[model samples]
Target: MGPNMLILASAAVLLLCGAANAARILALVPVASRSHHIWNSALTVGLAKKGHQIWALSPDNLEDNIYPNLTQMVIKGTYEKLREDFTMESFVEDSPFTFLKTMWAFGINVCRYESSTQAVKDLLKMPRDFFDLIITEVVFGECMFMFLHHFGGGTRIPVVGITAFGMGPWTDVLTGARTLPSVFAFPILPYVSKMSFTERLQNTLLTGYHWNNMIREYYPEQQKIAEEAYGEPLPPLIDLASNISVILVNNHYVLNGPQAQLPGIIDVGAMQCSPAQRLPKDISSFLNEAKIGAIYFSLGSNLMSELLPKDKLEVIVATFASLGPGIRVLWKFDPKVPIGHLPSNVLLKKWLPQEDVLGHPKTLAFVSHAGLLSTQEAIYHGVPIVAVPFFADQHTNARRLVELGVAVHVDFLTLTKESFKEKILNVTINPRYAENMRKMSNLLRDQPETPLDRAIFWVEFALRQGNDGMKALRSAGFDLAWYQYFLIDVLAAVLIAIVSPLLLIYVTMKTVMNKLRGNSKSKKKKL
Candidate 1:
């Protein structure tokens, strides 16, 4: 009845009404990988379910009916180049940097190919098209920036950066460009937090190589492709990249080792993670039959296990045979691989539901390639692993798992049957690996809301924030020079201050000593 109460009630009503409004979002996920598709689709689908209109450009074949209020536009290209597993194997012979260069070149190929497509060209050319927020998956996806500016109408639009793996060089540079440390940001490399002098030098050089050569040089090419595709003028790629308000990484600091991160780099790590579902009766029966527990082995769907060398494959099969009846090996074997003479304890299947296997109580360990999604699932299930990482970020992922005390690593090149068997036995027999994994799982699962919920909340929050965006969240250091961000000038000032005082004291002391000597000489003459 009172004026004060009535005013407060009106304010509450306004806030409630604002919260209830839905905004249209355009999510561009223009990559071709099953894992990447799954991650992107889940986020967009979740947003649509929250009553927001979503127009998604993706590589997956999920229909609009599968998701409410989602407009699916698929980008068709010969993405099959990714599966030339034999070529990837040859990359192992090259140095890390060279291998990465080859991969980046391939990514640019994908970008150019995708840009030429009719769907992307048409989507950008749509008349007076606009959206409240632009969500894009970024890695080698710099071209997506044009969507923000072309449709932004000469104003800022909030953009969300999503990556299937953790932050790459560009995202690191984009989010915390100025403050990202050169010595310890081993985003996709294998290194502990504490660096030796030599390691620090390598890390710094590696960081510079990725930042300067790979990111800066390679990013603009995508923009050029976008400009040609749009057949219209567009803003500078650098300015557009800087405008990104938030980066939703598919990683958690708990799983990935501790590293400095900007506030805008939100970790919605396992947003696509699902609870273990029921396995088929046969698979369940096989797992339960294992007296000493079963291990799930899969290198993920992108690469086939059959590509493995015959000698190396023989060694692995022999190792499995050595495990005997006590422990069982459920290998996700490609039937085409022709793995001969499997032991009585080993069961090979062309396809197996991985999450269900890991979640089962009888499953003791996972032999994995250390992909981001698979690692999240293992941690979520509280199962330790023997990581046999081959290429890409897998090596770093494995190293991180080792750092977390939940995994033992085996180098694929030098791996003998003896070494593989030892690692598997070591992880399973040791209580420490499983214990550390459970401790991490508690931290991972103990969050306020699920990863999916957090992702949805932040996305909608960005939509509501509008043009003002989270300008404060982005570091002002981006505007500053590298030396200024590093405080080199400040350090210089401090050094001068310290040296100036000491120099003054030394000069004064020397003057006083000379004067005392002169006084002593005069007194001697008088005597």
Candidate 2:
């Protein structure tokens, strides 16, 4: 063939190859939280960059999502519904049980709202195999798993689960991963894995709460909502949840310490973390000009710093002022909130570019609420922290950081200017915290491939393997009943075997002794 003809032929083959590899994915992030959206966006956008077509359904906007291959289908007003009902006060004051109940309720409502959306309805109208794979946030949004059945038709569309935090007890059940209370802490509880008896009791009870309350009570409720939304009865949500192909959890063993995970459970923590970018001109100048160093303060998205009680806010303001002229404080404060006077060392912006600020060499320490994303970012940047955890897994994250020697914990409920200042200074002024953080940062960065890349590869692998190949990775333990899984029947049989043989031998010996005694009595009577 001529050169021109040959080039055209090669280009045609390449196009065919590209067309064959491209996958259609539906990414569901029904949890109405910005942080969760960050984790989901990383996966979806990363996949899109790799030539996959992605339709991301989320309640919140995907951060910096501008890919042509990726589209965002908004779940309208889901977050507003959350904001209308919950506040920072409620989060801090809620006990574990109350928090679990409240979260389950929110999850049910989210399922109803998401399933009713035009985007979901349109997707449902498509053929069962329309999408090659479904990636979803399974933390507080297991109800979204109903789409697995709706789209599965006869054969299932593979699903990959993602969570914005470490794998907890619920993750264990869903993925058939093992989590001993002795080796792994319950994510919501403020105890470490190596706990005292009392702490283990609490952790075990919390674990049971997942089975009894979440699986039994919460899943049933979500199942009903899913059926109502679909306008038909569907397969059980728990079964669908267990059918996940792979789980990309947003935690690393370096942070949470190591634990047993099934083959399908993958650690893709810090997927959202990236190299530092240039900050705004004004912010860059402020940090670069700091005489000593700077500190970044944020309570994450869910817990707003502006929502802090007046007294606590006052304490924070005063503490920041007393940090001395050399050290600058970039407090992520809402501009709308009025403050009559301000300290010269303190700067307030409604939103600061969090990762960029933490990545700055001038950034010395962080004052954080210990949200997983923030904690991961701090770990990535080698910045020590003053963890002022308020609720949920914040307490556990804070405790882990302290155990790792990279942070000092301060109780938010009992926060005072003195205590806050002390905690901040303990991490900032001391060289030990910085050294430990540097070591952690190195460990987290020393990976073979980026976490996002690993996540994307597994997703595409699932697409290629389809449902059956993914099913092989699922833990067989999930198919067993509780009694079977624990081997209660086997244990009972072994116990009976040993006890019955011993009892028989004892009865035989006792009968022979009685016969001997009777013969002796008869001889004595004859004499």
Against the true structure, whose lDDT is highest? 2
Q: What is the lDDT of every predicted structure here?
A: 0.77, 0.82
Clashes of 1: 0
Q: Output the TM-score of candidate 1.
A: 0.85
- Tens digits of per-residue lDDT for model 1, 436-455: 99998888898889888988
Scored by Cα lDDT, where does model 2 land?
0.82
Q: For every model in order, what is the number of clashing pairs?
A: 0, 0
Give the per-residue Cα lDDT of candidate 1 at 409.
94
Model 2 spans > 4 angstroms off: 1-20, 153-156, 502-527
C-alpha root-mean-square deviation, candidate 2: 5.1
lDDT of 2 by residue, 243-291 (tens): 7868898879888887777888899999999989999998998888899
Sliding window of 10 residues with minimal summed lDDT for model 2: 9-18
List the candidates' TM-scores in order: 0.85, 0.91
